[model samples]
Target: MSFTNKIKKKGPVDIVKPADEVFDNVYPTRISNISYESVIESQKAVKEFEDKDRDILIKNLKSAYEEVFIKIIEGCMLSDYIDTIYNNLPEKIKEDFDESKCISQLLNSVNIYLVSSKMGGDKTSDEREIPSDTVESIVLSKKELHDNIANKKFEEANKRGKLNNAVRLGCYIRDTKRYFASEGFIQAKASSIHSFEDVSEHCSIFLWVDNIYDISKKNDNPSFEALFTFVLLHELMHLMMDVFDETKFGINGAGNLKDLGQLYGYFREESLANALALYLCDATRNDALVYSILDYFVEGQTTPYQTGLLYIEKDLLKKAVTNWMKCKKGKYLTKQLAKEWLLEVTTESPRQSELTRIEDAIATLVP
Candidate 1:
């Protein structure tokens, strides 16, 4: 009946795509950090297989892949030795499909571990620069926003209002904490893990903020500023991931296995989003703010969203899994937002505007 219901019927198998397309470039964790010069030297050192050893090499490579799968089943990400084995396999030895893709998927799982909480973007980040928002631009945008809001053009006003706030905050953080580079950030708005857009010569981040009103609020630990700022920084990093690395995003078309051959796709965008948020929190030294998110990010509260619906509070994933399991072909699928029954704060009557609903959901999650 609903989109979330359709997904639950499909299951999680289609949730991930092969890393060669959706993931960051060749991040077979084993070789992710290996140097080009070293790779070159290794290439130079490749000796031709002896006639007898040819069969041995293929057997060994396939055998190693078998063992590798076993290790993966047990959750062990053995390093670049994986890359070496895959590359050494002659083209004819394997014919059905990619045996290595699963390995890459499992290896890239380490991307969760591979990113240092303190690391900024690579050199390309330094080279890309963000254009500063001038005071005139900021003032003009705000005035226009106020008029639009006064006229009840909320959607249009929201678009203009975020730029000044995002740009100003981004400039301040880059100057002090050095968490992000000087450029390649975008100011944007959205309700979910959306993708790319160009803004001020940088990619725009489409993250949802619970309360745009909280922009001017000070040091509210679990408030909108804390949540919005962190999301802002995280999305900027995602833009960079697109530029320089294979995004750890996954791909699973709607038909489930009907389209398994597709490659290079969307991030479990939220996975990278949460990861980036964790690091940005550390970089900003905002303990209380980051701790608030601990229930969701560090504790792995995201799996619930895979059902493609929304919820709130304890046992988020567990509830989602249960609901998903109950979903049936003939029944009307039920996917409820945690506060679907709650009254909108922006309204006095028992009615919810679409914006009110989105904002309320954001408040529930971010707070």
Candidate 2:
């Protein structure tokens, strides 16, 4: 069965929403009108609930997994799979690919933590319910702070009040920090964004257990296992470029893909990373059907996640990642040259046979 058909048969019917609905729900509108004092109290109440729920979720995860989630981590290592993928690299660059070194970097370079999410962008039906009142208060407080600066009214900054603006600002900072450690914590499935900075010593990846646990309950447990494995590999790919690729050419680094995308609008690093992870999963499992279901799950995500499937469909993933590794310096100029090379080698005129080949390519991956 095809990936889509399999998902339709076994996956949740609501898992894949129509594109318009996806966009609308992904960027939901939130408004708040609660007072600052009320916001503080609501935040406290929310935090208490969140802390209790997080503890319970963590306990359940550990208890369910026999007190260790190491299997999932071990499964993602894929040493032989990495070797196979790099074996196809050109002879000159093949020498630079060290499986042991890469694995070491993966293990030593960053700390991984499984934690609960703050539920900012949560859409799962089984998600732990944060009180609506508390949520509204948090949103309104943030909005009020934003409007004060945006409108240049500085209503909160007025010196006429008995309580000084400095005091109010400090309160705002404290409350927000208590409610959310960082905005990223609220939305990311797994994050390596901090691992990009050269000076950052405390690089970490947080796998949001709240979302994962809820999603796992909705589907069979193995599906959750595969989903977790894919997410970790994706983040690890980013970490490899950030910490292991000594050339300092981490795709998302300052002058690499991140800057390239911002300056010239060439943004395929996320897609590349996603494609690389998908390949690793397929290689590690050698089960085309399992990987296909994973692919369908990714399709339900936002555009960046879905774009990588194009590379797989076009049979360009192997070539694309190999070219990426070949160009040691991930600068715009360097990538421009690589892009030209890719186009030159893969370019072809419209032909019916080529169309048939492309369709077959996609089918083979999913079959």
Candidate 3:
């Protein structure tokens, strides 16, 4: 009377007949079942074999099923169906298998694959927030800013320059936050520290804007972009020093030059940090400051000598400041010794070049 009673009475009806009955339940009569019938007929063509080949066939079928299951899960298909299918897998195939672990690994792989397929990955959406206290802060469209620069609107150009600096700072802050978050560190508030003393205390950033007159009077030889690149690199060098020290030693590591002079005793580490910072800035912004710093080290000539002097009188002095900022050995280096080390590394020093190359290689491995 019914299909089930008919199949039972027939003593295991033909696989093809049962398959066709199942298909009829799946498809409406209005749509032709020709394709479904072909699939069933093809399945029927798989014949019983000897014991050895039968084992091989079973293994292949299990592998195929696993592949299909993984693909379905990756597509975000029906979760309940996935569970049911997984549960129905043969005991030997499911032995020692962890469904949760398998699903997590597959999901991670899918996320990484999708992210890598995009242009810049997640970096594109990480927009920075500009602080309200920044002078003359105004958001401008990228196209309009480019047009202003092209038309030589000097006033607008300067304003755009300030905004660009703010954006750059914001990006750095965002990156720092990500770095801390990845390391399981709680994020502190984002605010400016007005003094070096204050900066050494809290996890903070200080933005130093050179006097406008000082910047404006310079002959248009060095582009504003170039100036911004240099100053930012210099400050970032200090920031990296702080970050490394904080991560390695912790917050209590900060003190006056005399208090924690031991850390700078290793001149090689300080030089490496400075060089690495420049390399990172160049890789990210294509900044000329990278070359300028390299040239200062290699040729002993500063591109913008005035800015260099204003920031630090000499390479020796700059090295001293770096040592003061980062040295942990608790031993003080005399001003003369700092200058000697700085000159030794910057002039025809193969060691400095090797350090720079190492930094370049490390940058490629990060992000």
Candidate 4:
């Protein structure tokens, strides 16, 4: 039987794993052999897609989305599957896990778009450009600027020093922007609620084909399907928890209102998204694919993402997800809350050693 058939029949609890077999059946040697260079060369060759070609590509992706991800979410909502998470959650938060909200309605609301790359990495619009004329005119004869400044006749030295400062400042600004662009912002992103104001009323998820391939090449080359599904799950969670009121969080992750106007995107929110995604993978029994995907998120990623997975691994997943869904604007699982909950759990449970490690982990994050 096909994998989808297997999934529908067994639900998440009994779904099959050894992801390679299922992926091979569907994609058939299409993804495993892909390399960073190969993806780059193929994209470079295409230049731009004609209207008809773009439509066909999107059509195919939507079909695959229905066949794969839709079923994956469906299976998670099935009786034995969701019960694993729902049953463990506190009574107050149980309402969010009800059949109505857990349905595919939220899944279908997000629109997907394909792009080659997002622009921040290439250049910063605000970056200052060095003056070409000034650079060309400068001729530094002396080894040191201070030495030239000592000589009363060294007017040229002064010009060279100013030019050198401008060039250095320009380079420094350019490099800093590039680093912040790549690190602070997600390469693959889902449109925030604000996007609805200018774009269509519906939210959109952008799949940067170039960035996807590049990340895959960096990680241990998990199947493209597996990675895409994980990314979609991450983005989807963001959409679900999205709120217009930043006042709900009151303070930033750092305990200040410096970024009060912005929606909270700190450890609690990110980890909840990741922990919930990891929970789905576990409930679905997709161990083979899930472990690699987990590593993909945990390894070489920023603090919040890594810490998010750590929360899941430490067995706070069900509660963490529950709090994010039910509490005040999904901001209840703050670092302070996590520490308090961990202390409670550690005191009541026999797994003192394991809980200690989690406590140590949470200590590193801001309260």
Candidate 5:
């Protein structure tokens, strides 16, 4: 009955190899040639298909839709159900529920959710260990004051959780500066090595928070809700590509789970990750946050590689947007059924947002 099981598509193994060296979110990692050129060439071939191959595109489209749809839902903070996210629209944002605007709002809101760390890292909820920084918000009302101050602690203690001091402190300071969502660290490995499944058959995320925190602190301009949200969605996209690559890659092929098929180009994974995040943002019509995240990558970066990846990401996102905008079913995939699935999951059983994250923790602690 779970949408995850229904939608998770392993597809086929890709024969394409990655380049020997590829940038993984600015850091270069070694990979074989099962990579960018291979992926693009295969795609170009399929895209150039004659009318007879149009059916192939349709099947690919359905597969891609389901894959990304699962990713979006998984990224969402479904508490019992995805109850009313974006309820507290920023006062600065105009009151309009048009599709584009709503998408922006959702993107913005989720970053706020992420930065606030309100989602409670990896489901089981041990976010409270981090120190709260909502000390003196003159603006927060009594309830707002309590919620903001009370945010660091998870409402439950059933999970084995570890706190990343630096990341949590960064969020704490930022939270003190802004009365937004709380922040918490998930059970991802701290590395620059971005891989879906490591040699140990474990899924890991490498967030060099020190580096990211450095980038974060550099910007004097206060608006980065989009950038933050984009980063979170980007990580989620890795999961999508790792588990349901054919949905995005559209290459009718096969590969081993550990094969770094998606890890190609200078910033191949990152560029595509950003593309997927942007697509989900558009599909949901979370326009404001969409622009917020895009604008940062577009105009706000200083690091040479960051700037370079943004340039590359723009093109990647453009290709995805074009396909998605033209494909009505893709556009409606998540939006039309989000609320329904939310209700179903909430009523049937509270969906586990990070089963691997949870299982890993249990194994690590219990073993």
Candidate 6:
């Protein structure tokens, strides 16, 4: 019998549904109407749990966690492949899993679990149970999500390239938009391109196709889809930073503010953006690509001159997050004890200079 038939024979406990069903379940929401406010509130709530009564804090955390799951369910639905994967979960785990958290986290957790299982990595964790309020705020109705996908322009864009690449790009844009949106900002546009100059302010993303291919060529590996995915996430991080800075820090406060007469100010907002982006990227599914990128950095491998920007890009991301997390606990440079915290968190590596450059670049870009 065919794979589908065999999966069907395995019964309801087997999550071997058709790809379309899986896709639908994964991408259930539209790109519009995703607000940063909701995401901030969720994160803030997570932080606030520290001050709440223990029982209430756990309840609240569970609720916040569920919001992540709802996002995943929506994502799965959007990819049109919900049925194939749902049966793979244990009945108890599935029963306890919340369906209302940000679909991004849910999809991410599922992807991580699956990938880990396939690689013989640990996959014993249960789906995070979140509160209904958190879940409700993030979840979109099935009909609403389907309608949004139905209107995507990429359906046309996909028809223009090699079928597989086109489809991959299409899904990349869709998922990336969802990823950004889940963090609380709408993506005005997204596209795959040949260079950074092709990046547009109006569009939220510009995936560099040629650059990706060049990297794969250098690595002598033809399959660079995973690498490309990492790049896409990096770019998306820039977009997220832009949005968060504008909304949280005010227009003047967004980006680097060194020229604005602020001393040692580049580390605050920019660092936070980098940190959040990295955290989200790391937390998301398909992180092996991210791991590979980090591995290259750890090994001190540099890309060709033309491709050096990619390393800079990734390094800045690492620096941004590290700096941001430090800032959060009042350990920024302005804080006399910041260096101590930094030493505790990071290893003695040449990457520190790269992080400084990234902070400098952010100041230039935002100013």
User: Which model scores highest in lDDT?
Assistant: 4
Please list the residue runs of candidate 1 whose C-alpha ends up more than 4 Å from where it truly belongs after superposition: 1-199, 206-221, 244-267, 295-367
Alpha-carbon lDDT of model 5: 0.29
The residue-by-residue lDDT of candidate 1 on 1-367, one tens digit each, is 3222333332211222222232321111121222222221121111133455334333433332233233332232323223433443335433433554523332322221112111223211213322333221212232343354345454443232343332222222211212121111122112111211111123332221112223323433344434444544444334323332212111122332111111001112233334444544554454665675554323423221111122222233223222221211011121122122211211223232442344344334321
- The candidate scoring highest on TM-score is 4
Where in model 3 is the C-alpha error above 4 Å?
Answer: 1-201, 244-274, 285-343, 346-367
Ranking by TM-score: 4, 2, 6, 5, 3, 1
RMSD of 3: 25.2
Off by over 4 Å in 2: 1-101, 119-202, 219-222, 244-260, 263-266, 286-296, 313-318, 325-330, 334-367
**Prediction 6 TM-score vs. true:** 0.29
For residue 182, model 6's alpha carbon misses the true position, in angstroms, by: 25
lDDT of 2 by residue, 1-367 (tens): 3222422432122232322243212211101111122222222212333666545443443332321123323444445335533443335433444544434323333433333344333432322122111111111232342343344333332211222111000001111122111121222122222221221122334345445545655764434445555665565555443322222232222332332222111124455667776766665554642554464466554333444555654345644444443322332224343223222222322233443344343333321
Candidate 5 lowest-lDDT run of ten = 257-266
> Total clashing residue pairs per candidate?
13, 0, 8, 0, 29, 50
Each candidate structure's TM-score, on Cα atoms with residue i matched to residue i, is: 0.24, 0.41, 0.26, 0.46, 0.27, 0.29
Per-model C-alpha lDDT, please? Answer: 0.28, 0.35, 0.30, 0.37, 0.29, 0.29
What is every candidate's alpha-carbon RMSD to the true fold? 19.3, 19.0, 25.2, 16.8, 24.8, 21.8
> Better model by lDDT, 4 or 6?
4
Q: How accurate is candidate 3 locally (lDDT)?
A: 0.30
Cα error, residue 277 of model 4, in Å, equals 1.9
Question: Which consecutive 10 residues in model 6 have the weakest lDDT in total?
Answer: 110-119
